[model samples]
Target: MNLIFHVRSERRVTFHPYSSLNDYIDHACCFHCRDGDWWLAKSLLTGDEGFIPCTFVAKAHSLEVERWFFKDLSRRETERLLVAPANKPGSFLIRESETTKGALSLSIRDLVAEEGDVVKHYKIRCLDNGGYYISPSITFSTLQELVKYYTRTADGLCQRLNAPCKAMLPQQPWAQDEWEIPRSTLKMMERLGAGQFGEVWMGYYKGRQKVAIKTLKEGTMEPAAFLQEANLMKKLKHDRLVHLHAVVTMEPILIVTEFMCNGCLLDFLKTEEGRKLKIPKLIDMSGQVAEGMAYIEGKNYIHRDLRAANILVNEMLHCKIADFGLARIIETEYKAQEGAKFPIKWTAPEAINYGTFTIKSDVWSFGILLTEIVTYGRIPYPGMTNPEVIRQLDQFYRMPCPEGCPEQLYDLMMGCWKEKPEERPTFEHLQHTLNDFFIATEGAYEMQP
Candidate 1:
């Protein structure tokens, strides 16, 4: 059997007499060729076969000089160099009469190669899995932007890229009909914030109901894992936990939940209201978070990222634990890859060095969160980078009490940050300690005001 391989010209070269059929060799031309440097090649484009220098052509390679299409090249020249004929699937071409090189003005005959009288041309905006134009007006400014958009939003690409987990995820009632929210009911408002795999938006549901819409930011998150998280979230319900409302199972996946009027706990503390925040209010907030975490602990769930940022607050100064994507449900210690990105300043020494995550490690993060509350969202380690913080922790260097921080609360923070994971106080213990403080101060606090 003759092996078929494509030949791409590295530079302009003339075909030898044995290969030439009165046709000149052009750049970016794809042709099937036999093995050998000076072998005969058959043009897939014009049905011409001739001997061409193998050194001049790259075998079955992508267009490396695509950057040149935007520089010093006319639209016609770009088409000639990079754009394959419409007959070729997965070929990119500029739209007719388009002078500016915008993603919206280009079309692709994606790998499907469907049969039709006129080949279907797909714009960058309409390339979603559902092929439904959610926003026809949105267009990428450049080719890189278009590439990025596809890399994240393409469901097929994301699945193929992300490695499958070794352990089988337990099946849950994730596909329940009542969990699905209609896409039309969600009116997206201002974007709240964004992370590696998702973006949060403050949205309105059913016209008047407020909700926080968490949407996957294209290719960042694995769909299976995302679904598992949603299912886990639905099963969990607590007063100090963020409430999940519904999930939109459409092209752009959305996880809708109750809107926290005050946003992230850390960000809120950094604002003017946080600066003037009373000790009683701070204690109340910390107690609430500890209560939520204790509930998670009871369920054998380890909240890996238990920092102030992952905690949300409401208008009434009520705090709730949020962002459980990194949280794990395990009986013992759970270890992850060593090089994975983790919150350095907030993590325990064991978690940072050995990749071990447990309830105790979460207690360590709770200590950091307490410091954040005391300092009104000031960073745990002042003027130290993550690496420096790690080095200091290794040397048993702990942060001193924040200014105006109560000595009793500071003692609890230190207990949570013990060198040995086993030595750290449990979330249940921490909650009781905070509750005692509040009870002792409530009469004084109330009488003073």
Candidate 2:
């Protein structure tokens, strides 16, 4: 059977049967037939025949074949891409409307308006004739034709299409080069610690770069499920989140990430150096975690496990969110599988009762994490079991503020632990508030000295 595929990465044909043919570059298209783990294909662009690795390309058809089509982009992500510096006015992209199933949204960046660069979105309607139209009066048999027509004339749009928004390539795991590193390149050193699925080790990449390598314990989890975190990490890149360097998909399934010199926030807080940290410094650390969570939330992701143990600190005391094994993209109807374990103390009431996790649930966990930070790694609801904590929460009882914790900071934590999920403050708001608090606290501390 004939199949169509889109080349996601640059591939040099070094294997037999097609070694002399041209290399397949990013965004290239090909028609191919499956040959074991390879694609015996003819390039649509150059008509060159080759046996390409299955991992080098992804099966694509219809609207997905278009560079401007972003199948899974959310409205917020669409706006962010359009307004990016690399994309100029008239840059546009087509995405499936989040609110309307099967409908498409045409988002375009316009020239600077009074409020600055404005992004306008138009809905593309489909007629009974199978033609597409934005204004109903102008119709095209195919979406590609419509894009071509719009590219030439604005007609009744904010601006004529100039170019597709600069593609954010990192969202696709295969788009990254040298991401599947050879096992020989990594030199495993001393064991750092162990977790639910594996042991983490302090390793050296190429004998120079320090990295944290986590090895999967056999029979602990399915390989695909174990690599889910790596796949998610590949898409998310932020200063406040631990960076994924590479992964070994072979047996042992190693995940290598940027090494945090100071280790986990929980352990760090209990250390001598951590105990000496001032109130302003602690606030600054909390703000950093909030900033990272804000970025993750904005990207439509939820960190199901948002406890201090999952937060890591570098030598500079900069905190980053880590351990994304339990994280997932926010979806309409998501519930953890039956028998799946979750930290009850760090979980929200709704999440504990229904296994339903959302960004708001993460906020509740953040409040528990705040208690940990304030009390230097004290367990939440001390002297109470998980069931007791749940019972107390049902009675509308919240954790009392830790001793020496600032009143304003404690108030922020309480706001995060609201009974209703919708009543909780968003990570974005938390980040801004914490940042402002840190600035004020730092100024007052300086004045005292």
Candidate 1, 1-449: lDDT as tens digits? 34344443333334433445322334334445445335566665666666665433443433322321222333322322222221233334333234334333333333322321112233334454424231354445454454545545543221111110111111111123547778998899999898876789998876756689988766555667677777877777787899777887655688888788789998999888666666755776788889899999999998899999989976556688988777777878788766789889999999889899999999999999999998889988989999999899989999988998989999999999899999999999988788567445323111100
Residue pairs clashing, model 2: none
Give the per-residue lDDT digits (tens) of candidate 2, residues 1-449: 55667764444544333533454544455554665446666776677786665545666655665668888887655765676556879999999988889998888888644445657788888989899988767789999999999999988788899998765322111214768888998999989899887889998877756689988877766767757756776789897898887898777888888888889999999999788665656776888899999999998888899999899987656789998777777665358888889999999999988889999999999999999999999999999998899899889889898999999999999999998999999999999897777344322111100
For each candidate, the alpha-carbon lDDT, in order, equals 0.65, 0.79
lDDT of 1: 0.65
In the order shown, what is each candidate's alpha-carbon RMSD? 26.2, 14.0
